[model samples]
Target: MDRIRKIFLVSINNIRKWATNPRIYVLFILITMFLWSSIRPILSFSKEMGIRVTPWVFPHLASSFVGQLILMLGVVLLFCDAPFIDEGQPYFLIRSGRYTWGMGQVFYIMMGMTIYLLIVNFISILILMPNIFLSTGWGKILGTLAENHGESVNEIEYISKKILLSYTPLKAFVLSFILEWCAGTALALLMFVINICLNRAAGATIASLIILLDYAIYSNFPSVKFFYFSPVSLSKLILIDSKGISNYPSNEYAYIFFIITIIVLSIISVLSVRRKDIQVQPAV
Candidate 1:
């Protein structure tokens, strides 16, 4: 118990120092602005139509555009090196045993991912404050069927059906927030594991490219959507088919996959960090 408390204190201190960096705030603002841009048109349309929009709409749209690609890359860049490559790492490890240090990194990565998503989603909700409201129901616009009969017909119908059949707005939003945080943590762990074997920049690049490639392959061959690393599958699980529904993997399966992936990646990360040599130069 005492050892655990010590590790928690050390991890919290590390998080505090990390939180003080201006780049973190800059990234938050940049991401918030980018997400707002994507949602601005939808909010404008909702206003023009004089319809009340669900609070979840902004987060749903933001998650779709942000996608697994950006989420994985953002986490990789934000946390890959900070955990193990700092010049202060040796001192930290000496003060807090290897296991504690490893656990601290895990805690930091998980907390950072959660906080980052919370801030992004909070900003999105704030942007649509006028329209945001709690409801166990779908918004009128989303509940309505798409009138278009061309290439978008199938996509629109799928999304409408999924939203109508799935959990309530607030329930869905909460589930999505939790699931996306888990998925992001798994992705961050994977990056950290890679960074243990490679430099931070290379680790981030390779991990990001791996996700992008998975997305590309999943796009071309929908049958492969059940693959564990498929970003499309993760997005489906996180966004609840906000963009559109796919035929390969169901929402249930995607959620299960993320849970399993999280467990697996977390184990790998902790084991790797425990055995890793903390010799890298401090991050610039």
Candidate 2:
């Protein structure tokens, strides 16, 4: 129990130090650019039509393939400095024991990813503050855009019709958030494991290569077999057909794939931290 508390303390301290982290600002800047492009179109459509929207705009903003791609890349930048270690970390690790320290690093990944995703969602809502409202439905313009968005609608504005037909606004938003969190956490873990087992440069590089590879393979291949191994695809609900007859993997399969991958990577992370000589260099 005391060890658990110590681990939590380490994780919390890491979170607190995020104020000193430059990457956090860079992440927000990236997110704002991506989100502004996404939300601006919706806001424009709403103003032209004079119709208020539901609070579920975030899902649509993140629904497109391009949005997801940028998001994956941004998350890579967000946690690029995985294991979040500095010169001060070595002394702390000595006091906390590598086992507790390793677990704390894992906790940091979980917390950090959660914060990243929540910021995305919050900014989406914030952008649409006056124009959007709390509602169970996808609202006027979103509903139309989802099903039969005419030529008048900008190409930048998008929400999958399959999403509207298959799930409610709340469900779509909830699922998108959950899936992104899972995939982002998985990527962070991959970086963490590699950073501990190998070197920092290799860790970030390999994780990025995997992401680019995943996007290329899935984008080009588009096969059910491929989805079984792809991390980013699991975040895409549009790929999953409601009838279960499409080529995409089912929801159940995506969850299992993510859970298994995260668990295995997390186990490796703990083991690596405990057994490996994880050297920390001074922050420059």
Q: Can you give the lDDT of residue 119 in candidate 2? A: 83
RMSD of each: 4.3, 1.7
**Top-scoring candidate (lDDT):** 2
After superposing candidate 2 on the true structure, give the runs of residues whose Cα lies further than 4 Å from its correct spot: 155-157
- Would you list the clashing residue pairs of candidate 2? none
Instruction: Estimate, for each residue in 79-134, the C-alpha lDDT of model 2 and write its tens digit.
Output: 77777788778877989999999899888888888888888888888888878878
- Candidate 1 Cα errors over 4 Å, as ranges: 62-66, 82-84, 144-161, 224-232, 238-247
Give per-residue CA lDDT, model 1, range 50-108, as digits (tens). Answer: 77666665324424534445555666657756445565567777887877778888887
TM-score: model 1 vs. ground truth: 0.82
Superposed Cα deviation of residue 49, candidate 1 (Å): 1.7
Which 10 consecutive residues of model 1 have the lowest summed lDDT? 149-158
